[model samples]
Target chain A: MEFDMTKPVPETQPWSEKFWEGTKQGKLLIQVCKDCKSKIFYPRKFCPECWSGNLDWIEASGKAKIFTFSTAYDMVEPKFTDELPYTIAYVDLEEGIRMMTRIIECKPEDIRIDMEVEVVFQERGGYFLPYFRPVGKK
Target chain B: MSKGKIAIIGIGEVPTRNMPERTHWDIIYDTCMEAIKDSGLHKNDIEGAISVTPQAQPKIAAELSFGKLPEELGLKGCKDAVSVNAGGASTSNAIRLAEQWITSGIAKAVLVHHVTVHSTIPIPDLINFFARAGVDLQWEYPYGTTYNIIMGLMANRYMHESDCKPEEMASVVTALRSWAAKDTNSFFYGKEVPSVEKVLASALLNTPLHKRESNVLGDGGSAMVIVSAEDAKKMKRPAAYKLGDSVRYFSGTCVMRDFYKVAEGFVVTAKEAMAQAGITKEDVSLWNCYLAYPLAHPLIAELLEVAPQGMGGKYFLEGRMSFGGDIPWSSIGDAPGRGHTGSGVSTACYVETARQLMGKAGERQVKNCKYVYQNAGGGSGFNNIATIWGKEI
Candidate 1:
């Protein structure tokens, strides 16, 4: 499927450029605090745990477990109308960070809490967005 | 240091249903006028004014073109007049700010007002506005996460962790509808109360949240006149004094916090407010909880210590929160039945509580109401504000 340019695109900030660039190269990245050794998601410039500005990036293992999820059947933005019954979820990755992502390649009913999955990328709005799918599927 | 000296002497609200003809400022002006008239005080008695709306624009520019509330309302003695935007917690926070002003002698009497015109916006724009208001644009918004989806994710996790069945959650909807049926001002007033089965069977807005579980948006306005305790005794109407008040801000983004502890902020703020009031959980005669969604009703009840953790839904299931029940929570239909009117829902809670304390709530009044606990939060428990109102000092 082609990317939907009409959808909102991530505005990469000075701090988040590295993470977005990693996604473009088909890699999932998370931030690690150099001072406190804490793991972070959504790529913050400073460590929220210790307020430390010393941060580094690491490639994720691409493994995850569904923490929770919800499937939208209605009330979505008009641009997202074509992708009805879409599931948005929070997944606990092997890197010790919980990320908000979309779950694909499985029926909504089949999705369960703590279900193991792995990361996959799909281009959207000119960015390769990382999504999760049930392990051993597609 | 003591906020107990301030009291709410009067409260007013416009009919909280669809009113397409009324402008945003019209509702704000009329609500403030009604509240002032109800207080048995002239407009000149107002010394300060605070306005709360959901819009991101400044208060003066958003509410009226000519001037702020002090000038528009003709308060020549007004010492302070400003606007506040705290999402659903704005009104309660506004009251807290007004209390500080009165106790500090910055103003002898203060007027707090809130109005919303959510119904005037088109569906697509409304959806977009709500989406931006709740989601993190740089990360979550691009992924198509809307407000309902955020609440849906929270509900799913909460139900899984607590083993809360859908029927138990549906019981909250059933109870709220039952309460709304009694209030003539509610949007769902005189409507049939949906059964638990019907609620569960309703169209699923998102997984684990049925259509009826979400609030119905409407246009409405609410205002309150608060003054010092000394001034309150001189008024013709009975007063609801502020026993305690607290506001806490954690994280604006929902994903940054632990989803399991989503209601933790409510617990902290409520505990502080109750401690300040020198009361325990049992001293609360009525609970005017801000029920923006069905899931929140149970979650907030647990956090406020009215019901034990994991038992909030059970309280609703057993009918313990209905009018005349043991807990007497949400006696005036709250946001779900009254229709969520942006930040005005918070002020509406205070309005209903004041009426109950003054023995003015017609049919749904809590008998011998002495102390009322009001709680409101914004941005999925990002900022929690709690207030305790008492009939006696």
Candidate 2:
């Protein structure tokens, strides 16, 4: 059954717009503290480590490894019903930042902690949503 | 302020179930009135009030709707009134705030109130509420990371790191169900306790989380009245003194912290509260660790040093967390069996602990329950509050 892909879209704030725009352009951008060189995810206005406002964005390598994962077989939102058994995972990027994303192109049972994976963008609701899949898989 | 300066003199809780007909305000009113009556004090004696809710509604909304609990409940001399919105940690945080108010002379008597009516809303709306309340809306919610999924991720990581078998996780549920069966107010009351095999065979809501392992959400309300130590002595009933309290914070997201070290904030908050109480783990007579998810029981146990790290499941398997165990944990059932009602968990924990300390818990009471340690966390370990309640100053 085909499900409605018109799920809730994020209301981007001024600071996070660039990160979303980068995702649309097929590049994973992460914020970095200009002073302390500490990498940050989810695009915060100030550096969590150094409290530095002098921040810059760097394109991530689009590579990460699965830190942990869970597959939802039931009790999901109606909009997500068609995507039954979808795997949600937290992946550790090589830059030392962790991202919450979906894992596709593999059986749910095959997903394992610390397994290497890479980012892939899927267009939804006129926006590019980043998901991850096991490395070396089509 | 020094420890044991404030005491929970009275507590009350409304029956927990799916009460779609009742509004959140209605439940709050009922619980607060019941608590005041239990305290044997006039409403005019309440000088301060703290309200807690987990939905997107702000504290101001509660006051605007409920008309300042002090006024609605006919409190004539109320001087301070505030609403707390720390999610699951709101009740514990509210209790801590009440203690501070009594210690600072801001108020001689304070009432802490909590209510949740999520079941009154539509399922989809409730799901949306959970997503918006706990997840990072701009980045995580859009990606479909709901609260259950976040817990699922945590459970998966915890199992992987601890090498905790599926059967051991199921045992946590089995044991909690047995406890709930004994509590008349528990959602699982009158229900047959599920065996470990039954729990393991239950349908999986999310991979690694059986249907029995997740929280059974419901609607409920609870209230507690706290007064200065001097006033507590004059109360009609025995009082549960506030020995120590601490609130700690960590990353808002599960991915930000080391997955293997999931209980970092719990450990910090527990230690701080214990130290402030001038007590150690051995001194605690009862333990009320929040168990919204069965996987959290062992993790929190390990964090609190009730059991060795990675050996919490073993503690449960050996029947150590049961009523007859050396350390009586969740004798009235944790969230999974008692029912998860937003801020009601912590408030209910306080009420249960007070009852045990006062020798009021008939069947579920623990022996020698003098010092009761109750702890709660909010938003997937983003915030935590630990409180120690003693039978004496």
Candidate 3:
């Protein structure tokens, strides 16, 4: 899809800059809270579990399971109408973090709950958006 | 048992409509005049004014935010004024805050009102406005996060976790619409009440959700006069006494982060409200839970223990939520069919339920509606508040 100024894009926060930087390189990074031994995603400044600020980033395996999904057949934001019949899904990564992303390169009928999938990146307005699809597909 | 310290003595509602000719001030004037007239109290009797922030206006909207309504209506001696937003839950918030002002000796009577002017907003932009209400601007909206998409995703997951099928939910729309069609005040009153088959066949707005399966938005408003229990007896109209209520907001971006907690939120409010009222589930003769998205009604039914788990959809299918059903949203039609007035439909539900309890619901009255259970909040996430009401304090 071509870049459109009307469409929404992320305004990367200071804490989330590393995540965006990693996405630009086509790598999926999960933030780990060292104090609570927990993993975080979307980049929190403090650990949600233990409220600890000690954190680190780990590259993920890119594998996930479909937690749930739905396809927009109609009535989306006007700016997104050009890309009709697209799927939005929340996928659970191997690290056990549920992230909201889209499922691409698969028919709506083929997407099912608990379906195996992996992360792939697409360039949108100079930023890589992580989307998932059925595993083992090009 | 929790005491009934407060009661709603008066109500006014302007039927949901496109209403292009009416201005925002006209709606506020009409609703408040009807309610204040019904209240049997003059401007001096009103001590405070509360309103929900409206969504449809120009650069500056809901100008009544700073107790402007009391001033505009010449509410003499009106010392307290404030505006609040909690989405549909804002309706309940207005009433709850009124109770506070009255209890603290700050106000003898409080006027709580909500109004939205959709006529001014372009028709196409209406969906865009409602969709953005529940989404995170940075994280979610850019990825085409429309309200329908969010509701559909929640419904999609609700079906997956509860074994509710798309076909079963069709009956919910049909049953709820029947109630809406019965009331002239409802947006769907003259509109067709689609059959279960038609609902399932309606054009898909989002996967697993049909266009007919959700709610309709319109321009309208509802207002009420709430007073201390002592003053309720002086009113000509029968007051709907507050038996018990539980209100709270779990503020956050998305509930999907911990989806399981959604069930906990539903159960907590319902149980707390019922417990405070010193009543069991069997005591309520009517239910006025908000008709938010497709997922809200059934998900609430099951988790609140009103129905067995995974049986929320079946509960509606059995006609249990219809006019003669066990617990009904049909009496005066709810938000789904009645017309969602943005953040005020739940407020509208307050007016409708008070009407039912006061024996003023005419043709839409529920039999033996002595005690009613009602809920309203951010339908998709953020908050849900539950309350129980009675005919007598």
Candidate 4:
């Protein structure tokens, strides 16, 4: 029997297309405020702080600090059955905003809050995804 | 800063365990009405509102004002509102937002609501798989870790570092069961308490962490209404005032950090709360700390240096956490107990705190409780908040 899980599969909306593009470049990209001086992640057209319509995309420094993280042993989904006991994290970018991403190339016990990490790029489903490995490990 | 003079004029909860009959809006409406009734205020008195949850978009909940929740509850006049997403910290954030709104003169009174239907929300099995397959899934899901695993790891490390043990952790279950046994409204009401043996014998999801250390799931909604102390004084009933609140974020490299310490954010927020309230750790009589797992309590205690290294045991052994004592703790312990309810547990923590303050906590009420410490965790560990609630704010 397949493991039952919750949450509907997310569908890609048109506005999010660009987000997929930046991942392939091995660079993390997020929105920057045009009117006021601010940076945002997870790509948006306007500034969350100032609500400024003036916004543009900028590449990130590929640096992050592990804010908090978790590990999973249960393969609640079939696609994840083989990857049980993996790690996920909430990486706080040096730029201020936080993004949800996965950590790779490290043991679960090695992950900790405030761990420095750098981003790596990979392609999936014809789209780009941003993941991270320990800064010095790779 | 209403300058610490705001009371929780009303309190409402839709239900915790399960409610198949109610939609998210339906539960929100019910809890809102209950709060309105408790406050003795009409809808028009409410000039502001905050909805905390990602389950329902803020705009949808905002549109709910057209119905009885706001209209009949006398909130048709609300001028300021927001849908703040702080993960588990939503309730405390809601309280802070309400206080700011009232103090800023944006509105006289505000309603803060948090509702969750975890069963209704999707938890993808391949969440980590999808992310690691590289669509930028590095924070939590990449390693295929769920919230439980992360908490369990913390628990494992905490026990390894502290004097507490799995048996002592079982006290949380015993205490919660004892309280739930008394509260007929609780999800675990009438349930038998799990023996320490049972906790140890249970299958381990993460080493040193049993399945019984987490909170369970049930559909529910919670709401609180706040008014100025001046307005509260005019009411026929005595009021519940805003004592103080603080929100803190943690950032540092995991490498240089000590393994035994609680998350730096937890300590910072506790101090921030103390600073804001003009009180010391000694002044807080009721500590309603977050307990997503057993490790959180000890981690916070160790980090804050509030209690000596061994003080964590006294509270854990006595089941003070499960009973909702100062640093009163609750978590859907493991797979056996009430599992994670997502934002629902966040609301439940405040509900328990409010109940204790109002002297409505019945069997779980701590003696002479004057000050309460409530903390909420959120966003894969990036966000946290600690709130200080006092009887005479």
**RMSD (Å) per prediction:** 2.7, 2.6, 2.5, 7.3
Mark the regions of model 2 whose C-alpha exceeds 4 Å error after superposition.
Answer: A1-5, B21-26, B54-66, B234-236, B260-262
Each prediction's Cα lDDT score?
Answer: 0.81, 0.80, 0.79, 0.63
True-contact fraction per candidate equals: 0.69, 0.72, 0.58, 0.18
Select the stronger candidate by TM-score from 1 and 4.
Answer: 1
For model 3 the local lDDT of residue A138 reads 92
Greater lDDT among 1 and 4 belongs to 1
lDDT of 2 by residue, B71-142 (tens): 777789898788776767777778778878888889998988887776656665666566567677666776
Instruction: Tell me candidate 2's fraction of native contacts, as a decimal between 0 and 1.
Output: 0.72
Deviation of model 1 at B67, angstroms = 3.8
- Candidate 4 global TM-score: 0.70
Can you give the lDDT of residue B232 in candidate 4? 78
Better of 1 and 2 by lDDT: 1
Leading candidate by lDDT:
1
> Per-residue lDDT for B345-375 in model 1, tens only?
7778888888888877888888788989887
- The DockQ figures for the candidates are 0.53, 0.55, 0.51, 0.14
TM-score of each: 0.94, 0.93, 0.94, 0.70
Q: Candidate 3 lDDT, tens digit per residue, A69-132?
A: 8899887766788888998887889998887788999999899989999999988888888889
In candidate 1, stretches whose alpha carbon ends up further than 4 angstroms from where it belongs are A1-5, B1-3, B56-61, B64-66, B234-236
The alpha-carbon interface RMSD of model 3 comes to: 4.7
Winning candidate number (DockQ): 2
